[model samples]
Target: MVDMDLLLALASHARYRPDQLAVAFEDERLTYRQLERRVSQIVAAFRRLDLAPGDRIGIATYRGVDPVALYLGSQAAGLQPVMLSWTLGPALPEMAEALGVEHLFVGAEAAGLHNLATSGAQVWDVGGHTADIGGFLAQSEAEDERWIVRRDPDQVSSVEFSAGSTGRPKAILRTVRSDVWNAWQRILAYRACEGDRWLCITPMNLSVLSGMVRAVLVLGGSLVLLERFDAARTVAAIRDGVTILPLQTPHWSQILEQPDLGDIAEPRLRTAVAIGQRIPVGLARRITAAFPRADFVVSYGTSESGMITALSATDPAFGTPSCVGRPLPTLEVEVVDEGGRPVPPGVRGDICVRGPSVVAGYDPAVGPIVSSMYDDWFNTGDVGQWDQRGYLYVIDRRSDVFESEGQLVFPGEIQEEVSRLPNVREVAVAGVQLEEECQATVFVVSDRDNPDIASIASIEAAVARVSQVSFRIRSVDRLPRTLGGKLDRVALKRGQW
Candidate 1:
């Protein structure tokens, strides 16, 4: 059985490798010893405030040392840490209230952006001129160190909110056993080791972020944190010998377009995992070409089910259409039709998964929508198919597929085709309802400042080559994306452009 006490491992690291670099952010660096002390101090402060187990502690902060400390401290204290994204803006307070957040930790830099006080949760500033964390650490210095609180393995340790593109975000609960097991899978899939230096380009609000962090720390590896993504900075860091780099598709696209990318020397980067969305074949090729020494991998999973599939660079099906690779050895995946019967190879059906890593269920406040438990298996609203060899291929969200002219149309297929166009910077395909029938429409972001009609026509022709069905092509300066860097399809369907 796996030991779910993550803090014990962290404490061990501090005892043996106290001086080893644990985290790096810009010019700042923290050693394992420092990280352990900081986390302990935060835990003591939380105890002094009378916060108990099961109390929801909400955290909304820019990527930095303090945010990491807060997360570890909360988990060690048995408090459920609710990660909040800044993208919520003014509506953040309302969501916090819905989550029953009792205390909040906000980055000093982001304090001016939202009035979280109205949520009635006591707020603590972390880092910046305010130095709230520093004060807390100072006050707790003389207090006895509190041992890590141990809870039932099945109890919820953290709460993660969905992207909420369609409506209110759902609260997904993650248990200690599930979280630790998921992290182990990632470590195996990404080839993470004690010597590896992992780069984190996304915010910690993402479930993947915590898993990555935990995996690295547990293995005595170093984590290089960035407050925000900058293509040049990321490329520079890779050249400086970072081994593992995990980025979303959009980040890869932006970095690929950088003019200085070609000037950088061959990077020391070994593994690069594309998270959040599928990596277009064309983009994947470009990425491989840029970092000849790196492995370009595509990973797929949901909040309800921790990473289920991963296609390594060496896998022959890496860039194959809809291919997300075989399910991990730890999990079982199946595709079934409406009647709950297994589908044949190459046939489309709902993707169902069951494993120790699967989340128990969503918090009661968030209605049951994306995931449903049936016979010990969780039905992931995503539709997919499996090849003869058992490789899984995700088509699209069940709701995103629509009927056009009595023919089933998948927006993801159209989007993938349009994404191949050289002039198209980004594309989102959606089925628009017309008077008599529904038709597919492609929203394009151009590569040039002002794309002429000729360029637009070229993209249209390229899309037509892959999809015989007629589609209306429109250009937009920018495409809306969720905080997790996924295309906001719900917004596009509502004509929010």
Candidate 2:
């Protein structure tokens, strides 16, 4: 059996590699020795709080050194950190209720912040309690290591909430086995290694935090986190040698188009992975052109399924910018019809997967997200098909599929087609309800010099070529986006601008 104590493993890595840099902030670098000491003190601090092993603590803090300390310290204490978004401060009580969290570790800014309060939880301002983790480390003693609990691989390591595409976010309880294996899958597939630097520009609350924190810590890599995403800072980070940077499509696309990256000097920078949303074909091509030496990869997955698909420069179909790469190691992807039988090559069907990275189920699990598992396989709710050469291409979310004038329309297909139009930076397609049913409507970001009408006409011509055209077009200054920077299709359909 595998010894699944991440804290123990971290401590061991520190003991064996004391001189090696374990983490780095802007100007300060921490060696393994420093990290171990900090972890010890943080564990001591946890004892001061009177929290015990298996106690659920909610971590609602900003991204930076402190958040990382809280994460590691909680693990050291065998406390599961239920990570909550700072934006959802209003919903903390409900969220805490959902996760059964009793103790809250919040930031200084959030001391009095609460729209609703949990019945039996105490909120501690982590910022006020521990300003300098390294400083705290100086006082730590071997006796300070007050806890070393048995770790079951299956025991919940974290409780993450999924951005409910349909409605309210769903709480997901994840195990140490799934979390560690998922981190390894990313490392193996992406070739992440020691000394490689990663920047946390994505939301501190969700997928990026989940995948990145573990990957950076366990692999002895450095994580440069941003308080929020600033395009210039991103470009600067890439130019100044932040390798292995991952971003949502929109953010990375904008970064590539920035002229600033052309002048930055960094030899160690190598790969850039774009996740969260579909990368525009033109944007991907431009990004590759901009960073000639960088390995450009497009990743596809959800909060429920950690990185099920990855498209890398080495894939044979990598030339097709719309294809989001083949399934990475530790994942099995299949396209199935309504009857649950596998679809033929190039035929559209629901994309399903069986894998170690996939969440076993969700909390208060309902419907197919929980029950549709055929043993290990999961219905992904995404419509896709594999090519004869086995390249998986996601078409669209099955729930987003709509019929227009008796012809089935996949919103993704339209978005993909329009994404290739010249000067059209990005696009989101949603079906607007009419008298009886829904009709496709497109939203786009394009060069201000050119009217969106021209881009729409181009899309109309392409749709006509496929003979599946039946939609209207509307242009806005900017498309509404989710906190993660994905196009907010649901909000668009609801007439929320």
lDDT of each model, Cα atoms only? 0.78, 0.70
In candidate 2, what residue range of length 10 has the lowest lDDT sum?
Answer: 128-137
Q: Where does model 2 exceed 4 Å of error? A: 2-5, 16-21, 24-30, 108-112, 128-146, 164-166, 202-204, 365-372, 434-437, 448-455
Q: After superposition, how far is residue 439 of candidate 1 from its true place, in Å?
A: 4.2
lDDT of 2: 0.70
TM-score to true structure, per model = 0.92, 0.90
**TM-score top scorer:** 1
Q: Provide the global lDDT of candidate 1 against the true structure.
A: 0.78
Model 2: how far residue 235 lies from native, Å: 1.5
